[model samples]
Target: MEIKLEEKKIKLVLIILFLGMILPIFLTHQNFKIYDSITKALELWDKEHLLIGMLKLVIMNTLRSIPMYIAIFLLFDSIEIIKNGRKRNFEKVLLILPIIPIAYSLIKIFYDIQLPVGKTSILGVLWFCYYVKFDLKNITYVEKYLVFLSFIVGLQWLDVSRFFNFLGVGEITSDLNKAIIFMEADVIVTLICISFFSFFTLFSILLLHFFKGQEERIARSRSEMENRHLKEVQLLVHDLKTPIFSVGALLETLTLQEEDERKKLYLKKMEDSIEKTNVMISEILSVKSEKPIVIEEMMRFIFSFLSVHKNIEGITYKSYLKKDYKLKGNRILLSRVIINLIVNSWEANSSVVNIMVKDYKKRLIIQIDDCGDGIDIDNINELIKEGVSTKNSSGKGLSFVVKTIKEMEGKIYFVKKIKNGTKIYIILKGDEYGE
Candidate 1:
């Protein structure tokens, strides 16, 4: 099923992807070979010692692998159903099925059970192909972590970590006289296999997430700098406009005062030259002169403007300013955002673009909806990125939307329907709601 990639459901998918990649090898680690490896490695090669090490590996492997594998399948299927956007009951019902795998894993780990009679490598490989092609990586976190897990586990050589007795409990000891299930595998071998896959699985997730966050942060900082640069260029152009306009104005005055037709024409020519310069400056300045402020004032101005625009009579803009939520943007910059959205909506053939404030749970939500040609199928997200534009814009409107929202310490995204227009959703932290 096509699970829409939303932020909330990321963790579940990541867990599944991780397990699908790592579990088979992980569970197999605790199989019979470990008993031989440890017994041989330690020179305690007799049956008693072999059984002891093998049993320990089996128990520990079961403890880590069972619950983990169960978690993997449960979360994976839940995410699958959610991705499909299917009937809720089946998703809900299927959610609990993870418990059985979890129970199996846990019971094997913590309780005394004969190791199941199958080679675990087959299980590992089966789960591999299951997730490999599923490719549910439209989500960022999933894409980042799953790829990392698959790569690390692929070599099958970097197996790491062994003991996990954090439960503070020892394994249940079998009586000395009892023969364990037609034991084929050794303890140390199983432990090594389990340790390799299990450690790689667990550790790789933590590592990938940590790095992805850092990379995102760095990317964000780079983006913010670019916006600041845009603003800076605007400042430089705005600074230049006054002198250019002054020169053009002086030339215009000369043309009005001149009695000689030739001189009048020449003065008019100079006026035209500098006038173009002034126009370019204005467009440049129009985007650059920005500061930061609270959200309400901006909405108030936009809605107030929309209330009067004769061309926009059929369209309505609404505001939902929360009493306590505040944003880190100033009036001028925020006003520009409202104006741009309104204009873009109108341009896109939408009779109306709804602009409203909402309590997006703990965060503040500023939503812009328009019944226009929804965003271009391919470039909705592209537009928010720097240097991407449909109109060959100063290429700044939506980028401005993104920049301003971020300056306000918020985020903005477009949910565009394939046929209709788009919904621009911005979530901002105010008093960091539910903080």
Candidate 2:
């Protein structure tokens, strides 16, 4: 699939080259009448206002260069799309293309003159410079526009009349003497423009390349750091299983020896809690595998886990199970998700935390509500983002929940605008549902 996409992009690049460079040369012919009109316009403007005359010249030249600009922009944009597959704003390209032709037609109708309107290979040198600088470099619209303007302005300073003369398409004017003077002045300006924009293009390319390199380095550093942190966590989880095993063994011994029924029950509950912890730790260390989990059994396990923590002062956990449903997921991981949410509610100073499960239209719904210092409405959205935390801890808990739920093809929503507490809804597909 990737190879096919690359082949398509290569074909597009070839088409753009043919249309932008080769086809233009074959279709366009030198229009001396356009040149005559430009020189006359410049001569008239010079008599009225020299500054405005030069400005008009620059504008006319830029107008003539519009098609080339469009082609260059398209080529640059297409290359970027091919390399990165990220879409860029081509609105400027769209807006400019239609507007230029209409503007040129209006000018021709109003002034009774001809202007260079079609593509030409005359600006081939400038296009080459643009390709060299921008072909592989990612640049902003502002930089593109700036360089485009510079290219237009720089072309005005070139001795184009001399260039035409060299190509055997010399002066159309009857006065050779006037053309000689114009050519001499144009020579000096041409040399200066060439030196200036050449250095400008080179400097811009180098600066952009440097910034791209710095960004890539920063990304690599971040990835390496994350990988190291994950490895450390795996080692810690591996170390934790030994102590948990010892606790489980001790609880088993106590349950076997206890004579009183009440004491035996307490020890049995402890053993069950420790066993769940060991399973959770194992889940963390192993690659994920999903199986059908009966919702009632999962909730019972969660209730047991929460009951063990009920000794904490001023906290109450309530549950409402409307129906039994079967869901497909990692049971230990899913239980941890609920436990994490309940723990968060407790830490929020919540006096009561309610867990409710129901089935709606073949989907399983789990809602958690807490009345402690309910989450601030403003921070609700930020809560699920990795590294953002209201409690200033690692902030991975809710992010983990979100990721796990997504893996199970589930959706989670935080209900803002609630009267006095945080309300969360988790919706997932159910394999089976029963009353």
Candidate 3:
């Protein structure tokens, strides 16, 4: 099965490659007796047979290139996958399955050359790549490291006589073949192992950098999509504005013309509905728009908005307004703050939510008091934080409230807290209260 490569798996593959190279280099340098014995045999080999001598030279050169080729191929591909996610076609590394061992087998027929087990090494890695589907992001580092170690241990030392048979190469099983083959086997294996380790480690570092870079790209893409969606919604909402105004105007004209009280009342309800839609459109537009809102006028809208929820079981509200207060800020933002606080009180099963708008010296104090369970002592300190909501939602309501008030150059405080409920104070400059 073909598996798509992800960042973490690409990293693991690189580490396995480097480890494969490093361990063998260290082992060969320790004067293993096999190396000493292989040294004497290589010197005595038949330099007289021209074809065999040429084949031996070819095998040696090919063997030298194979490790470097594998390292470069795997390293470069892994980096490519990171930069641009999964590929549409097959990976290039699969070419090693047929090519490397077949080339080695040509030498095996005449010289009995000991080729590093390309079959096992490449197959093991490819098998892992296929199995992992290249997505190792969710796994722990320990599990990831263990898999890395297992690939080196299992495939690098794999022994199989049929590796030659699978490629349809005739194995020369004579005493001479065995002697020549086993003579350089240890040294060849050691060199391949060290090469694998050295290259794997070097490329692993490069893969890690690209992997992190891939994550950043994904995040940026997600954010851009969200921004585009927001823009589209705003445009759609803006398109809705004109029709809503026409409907509201039609309702007002009907209300003025109708002589019957019942029909006029119905028209009035329709006007209210259109006004609500208008306010909704205004709210959507005012999200990032800096618009001034009359506090007195906004309070009426808030009262109308809250009246819909007042009939909710156990919720009740009252308002005290001083009249004619104005503030320079986003109306939608101010409306959101009021609605959010009312919602908190409503959801808390408040028996009464008393809203007071007062003129105290040079400040307009809008206070809301709810008769329900008071704010938690511990939570009160963090109550204005985005996530601290009575309904246990995303908790952004109060945070938005605090932010909007700050933008209006205003202040808010939790003035009273008791067994019954809590009171919140919103204070704005008297200068903001225009004629």
Candidate 4:
């Protein structure tokens, strides 16, 4: 969805750019046409000048329309032709579609003209290419340049009548012969106009390339900074984990050796808190790690973790475990995910939480539903984004959960409940029962 939004913005920018490019041409054409009409009022408005003026208008209009033409083509993602429940071949259809009208138009305008109709409308195939996911933007730079060159050539071909006359190849009419003295002057002026416009287009392309280069450099810098920050974070997490491990081991030893009831209870609580911290630290560090874990053992650990939390101890809940399955991922990471979700539910002041685990043919589906004021529909998409949360905490829990699930090639999504709370569904790929 985000990618689609970005693409839409790009299209809008291109539309604005193309409109800007065409606006000047229209203004210039209108200004020149008025000036020329006034100056050449008494002069003979003969066949040659008429042809020249028409051809110039055609070329300018076609040039102005190029961007909009491409934009219109981009509006369709796919084009399918079906007849009698059978899909026809699209390749052949698109190749022939644009040429038919262009051929007719050309022939009607210039009965004696000759040009390759198929080759002239080659750019038209870009429409088909776009629909089939073969956009010009995806091609190599050199190939893109070649395509642009082809487009220029095609535009010239569309004005083949003027092109041939400029080349001194077309049949001469008696009316034009009478005005032959002015023909050389007209041809020279037309050539100059074409040359100027060509240079302008070239300059625009070069300017676009300069912008593209700057954008690429900025993207590269951002990627480098992200990589550096990731490395620093990994190092810091590793350093923190070493002391946490030692403390946890020492706490375990002390709790096992102590015999006094009050001291043992206090020690046990401390040990549980330390163990939870260790699990959270491990979750942060090894969220991407995929190790074999038994689902039943992980669930037992999750229940133990929840029992220690004061908030969740009083909440009514139901659990249905169809079967325990083996998954390949960090056990602590999954535990952290469940803990974050359960905590969120408790914070929402949910009276009841339902947990369901199902083993499928090739995946495991876990659903957690709560009966509190549900998440706002507007905030659903933003829930897993970093720095976004209902609680006033760091808001990294759900984000971390999302990242871990993605690393495991799993999916986590919200299923809106009918009553008041939110329902979160987690699907993880794993071996089917007895498979």
Candidate 5:
């Protein structure tokens, strides 16, 4: 609702703030002071006070550069969030976000026009954190190279002087130099050094950014490969888990028929071991399961499954929904989550299992109600994390449940109920079900 909309608006404002910071310097470089866009820009520079004027230039330039890195960094970090109607990649999305005040700043700085910016932004803070997290090592490498580049720039500045015309652009002519009263050798030489340094500084920033991007790309590729390997392992585990359960059942049948008492005991132990092995297999398969089916029929299939596997002992199960609900996701994975939740409830001495469903625009809000000794308040969040277990068996099953919900972009939270039962709410987004 309004809160979500406001959050998006806030992020948009921050983006503009960051974009504005870098716009001036980039535009200045590109425009070459032809003096068109922001003609008032030079007003900020006091020529009579050269120190103030130089400070104005440096401050404005750095302000503009910081946000450029931030916008670029966030663009990469959130590349996968393709929401609403935009399916654009990170680069395309950033391109759509405004250009680095390129042509406009160039025209303005040359004409001394100031570009007015609106509002404050945290892009400076955002980029500082990001650089420290991911780019510092690479930036240091670039800085080390920049030290050598500085010397080279100084030598090149010399070549553009006297008879050593490396760039032959413009050197002091004797007649023009004599006409300028303030043009002392010291002042002119200082200006040349400043300009030379500025050029090298900007060049180094761009080079560092480019290398940082390369490092990120390499990191992502390595991550994707690791996920691929994990998925392969998961599939292999799935193949192994299903048959172990069947083998366990076969062993149970043999145990009942065995005449020797010792042999029967051994058969029972084998059956128990097979069952334990099967659970482990399930845990492994849970790691890499794919998207769930969202059809109404599939949800029905899941309810029917619970009915078929209804506890023959002291446990009881109930389907509380009035009508069928539809969700897009892997039915198998969803079923596993449901089974684990129900098993946990049963273990907590709950005889009744209530599955309630409600329509939430495009989403289906499902709540599983269990009258049991609810989750430990302190450990609720931890239970969802990997390797966290509240049960006697391997903790992977509960971790898998949390992982599955996250994969679907859904959320799960433990609710404090007036009644003694625990309420676990699962919110599955409508858009995800379609996809």
Candidate 6:
């Protein structure tokens, strides 16, 4: 399946490049008035100042190629959207599109173009080679820019067209002979420049590729290390369950033996707390499959769990649950998610946390509001990313919540609050499961 997806991506990219390459040819097929005006303007500049004429030529060609650049950008961006099923920032395409025309102009400035090979053809070849070798979408922005710069410099300095033209054995016209003679004196200089730039560009690409590989390797190593640590922690938690089970059994024995009413009530509460701890430990150790659960029942368990286990001093909780709904998900995991959010609010020094649930027939809406040092509105999106946290702790709670919600085909949003607090809204597909 993965290989087939990759093949599809490759075919899409090739089609985009083919269209980009052919677009310039189609646009310049006929001699238009604008082309003639630009050519006459460049001629006028050439007669006055040679340097200015060359600069204008570069700029004019770049301007002419803007349509082709826009086409390529749209094609590439459309392909990305189709393949990834997500919208990307248009600014990224805009940022890279101008580089194509500028690079083509630079090549024209540095190399002498011969007949039978139009400037657009050379541009096509350069684009084809660069994109075929490196996928622009997959690389980092810095790497993309550097690799493109190296590609332009390498092709410009190679002057492959001149070398091929010089080696042609076909009958040459007098004009061609004269052009060869004119460039004859600079043969040695051209050869040296080609050799130096080719080697430099090749080395630069290799060095950059090596550094990219090293970075990927380091990232993979860190991931493996984290996985190993997580396994160790899981094992420790499993070991703790044995002692927890023993404590629950002892509490049960004491609760049954107590004769005093008040003391028996206290002992019963301790037993209940110990049993809840055992259930939590079991949840941590066992993976629960998705099942139909009553939303009201789950909320009741969550509220009771938080009130008993996480009743931090000076912190309060308020719930406004209006209707019952049936949701298809792991009940324990969902409970853990709400419990984690409330605990986070408590840790944030919230005086009060409010949880509101509303039923919308075929959907369920849950809103959690907290009166605490509010979350950074600007970094709300970043907060859900793994290893990202506003507080000084290992940032995994919200990440876990996000993953769990996604698994259940639900959406979570952090809405900006006008007052001194944070508002979180969650939407899930469900049905009314009456009282």
Q: Say which candidate scores most in lDDT.
A: 2
- Residues 259-320 of candidate 3 have per-residue lDDT tens digits of 99999987887788677877788777656766666777887776676655644444334334
lDDT of each: 0.54, 0.58, 0.56, 0.58, 0.53, 0.57
Poorest 10 consecutive residues of model 2 by lDDT?
A: 168-177
Model 2 stretches with alpha carbons more than 4 Å out: 1-221, 311-328, 358-364, 381-389, 392-394, 406-410, 428-435
Q: Tens-digit lDDT track for model 5 on 64-148?
A: 4444444444443333333453333433344424533452355456656454221111222222333433333433434534533
User: How good is model 6 by TM-score?
Assistant: 0.57
TM-score, cand. 5 vs. native: 0.43
RMSD of 4: 9.4
Q: Write the per-residue lDDT of candidate 1 for residues 1-435, one digit (tens) a residue.
A: 434333333566556445533444444544545535543534543445644554555454454444344444335543434332233434433454444344445455654443332223224434444443334323454544454444335223222222222312222212211223223333544455566566656665565556556667777888899789878888888788778877877887787888999998777766755764564456456644433445665565455555446556665555455554554435556666767887887778888666677665566676788888888644555677767777767777888888787766666677786668888777766434322
Whichever of 2 and 3 has more TM-score, that candidate is 2
Alpha-carbon deviation at 175 in model 1, angstroms: 11
**What's the ranking of the predictions by TM-score, best on top?**
4, 6, 2, 1, 5, 3
Measure candidate 5: CA RMSD.
12.1
Off by over 4 Å in 6: 1-144, 155-223, 288-294, 309-330, 357-365, 380-396, 402-411, 427-435
lDDT per residue, candidate 2, 22-90, as tens digits?
Answer: 322322223223444445645663322322333344344544554445555544454322113223334
After superposition on all CA atoms, what RMSD does each candidate show versus the true structure?
A: 11.5, 12.5, 18.0, 9.4, 12.1, 11.4
C-alpha displacement of 22 in model 5, angstroms? Answer: 24
The CA lDDT at 106 in model 4 is: 50
The reply for model 3, stretches above 4 Å from the true place, is: 1-233, 242-264, 286-292, 311-323, 380-395, 433-435
lDDT of candidate 1 at residue 238, scale 0 to 100: 77
lDDT of 4 by residue, 352-375 (tens): 777777766567788888887777
Q: What TM-score, computed on C-alpha atoms, does each candidate reach?
A: 0.45, 0.51, 0.40, 0.57, 0.43, 0.57
Structure candidate 6, residue pairs in collision: none
